[model samples]
Target: MILPITIYGHPVLRKVAKDIDKDYPELEKFKEDMWQTMYFSDGVGLAAPQVGKSIRMFVIDCSNFADEEPELEGFKKMFVNAKITERTGEEWSMSEGCLSIPGLNEDITRPEHIKIEYYDENWEFHEDEYSGFAARVIQHEYDHLEGILFTDHCAPIKKRLLKGKLTAISKGNFKAKYRFTLAK
Candidate 1:
């Protein structure tokens, strides 16, 4: 079922999510629910906190975007208690937006390449190295697990300028416009 996605000003979005306990048998179901929530929301990624659950787990499906194609074979992935094992090379600037902070995109700098270690649906450890848009999406969701939002990494001036707009949107001032835009 599609879960209600928490908005930017929600406290849960700022809270550091708890690590997923491997012994929890229901995590597989949770992953399924997250996937449904993300797909229904038309989001490329969704973190547990976005659904009001403070857990270090998130789902990613890059296939939804028409412009970007994931180089990896296996597309949809769930990361439980995921961590970045290594990040190397120069940082690259990418325009990023968040499910929590809707309608705003900011240029943020991140490592060009990253190696992430995470547990799959079966609770098996898997390590994947990624770059480009895929890496940016994973890193963005991973930050949610650590109580970090994309705005936290945004350029200071850009973020400051968007503060009022963000607040207004959160207050439902832009609901009508948002609905129309989302319809497209």
Candidate 2:
């Protein structure tokens, strides 16, 4: 199933997500839905909050960048109840966009490396470290679990300039190929 992504201004996007255990209802099915929704929406990453679920879960697949980064050829994983234990290395800027905030991409700066502990879709625990593009993608999705958006990291002036566009998005005035739910 392709879940409808919650658009900007959706209340759920602004709330911190809660952790879920192995007994989470239909966990496997939900994870499959998330993957379907993300792929359908042309997103490399998607978080639970973006799909109107307040749970600490997100999925990422960077295989599309395999040509550019061979290491990411098979980098696909689901993160549950993830916690970033550390962020190190110099910061770099890269353009980032979210499925929830479609048609908007901003140059966001983030650390180059991160250490995170999380459970896979099978509910198996694992702690791992990532760098470069992988780290950036992880951080972007992680922000969603913390009630933060990539635009929030933009310069003050950039935000002010984006106010009109963001308001339009909140009002369902933007175009997106995937299904979305606007704030009521």
Candidate 3:
């Protein structure tokens, strides 16, 4: 199923998510739903909080950028209870967009490398390192688990300038190709 993404200003988006174990209700099903929703919405990454679930889970598929980063070809994975152990390398700026914050894209600065620990769908634990675009996408989705948004990393002036547009988005004034729910 393609879950309804929670729009900006949704309280769930601002709450820190909790870790879930293998026994999380319908864990396997939920993971599939996340992947379906993400692909359906044309998003490279989607976090549990974005779907109104306060859990440390997210999915990423970067195959779309395979031409630019051959290593990312067919790279798809689900991260559960993920934790970033380290962030190294120089920071770089990249334009980022979120399904939860539709119609708004911002140039966000993030580290170029990261070491993280997470469990895959099989419930096996794994610690991995990623770089470049993969690292950026991971960090972006990880922020959702921490109740942080890409816009929060923007310059002060940029944020101020976006206030009106953000408010409009919260009020359902934006158009998105996927289904979403506005804050009550």
Residue 164 CA error for candidate 2 (Å)? 0.7
Task: Return the clash pairs for model 2, or none.
Answer: none
Writing each residue's lDDT as its tens digit, candidate 2 over 1-184 gives: 9999999999999999999998899998999999999999999999999999999999999999989889999999999999999999999999999888888999999999999999998888999999999999999999999999999999999999999989998999878998899988
Query: TM-score of each candidate?
Result: 0.86, 0.98, 0.98
User: If both were scored by TM-score, which would come out higher, candidate 1 or candidate 3?
Assistant: 3
lDDT of each: 0.78, 0.95, 0.95
Q: After superposition, how far is residue 99 of candidate 3 from its true place, in Å?
A: 0.6
TM-score of 2: 0.98
> Which of candidates 1 and 3 reaches a greater lDDT?
3
RMSD of candidate 3 to the truth, in angstroms, is 0.6
Going through the candidates in order, what is the number of backbone clashes in each?
0, 0, 0
Q: Which portions of model 1 show Cα errors greater than 4 Å?
A: 23-25, 64-74, 176-184
Q: Model 1 lDDT vs. the true structure? A: 0.78
In candidate 2 the C-alpha lDDT for residue 157 amounts to 99
Candidate 3 segments whose C-alpha is farther than 4 A from its true place: none
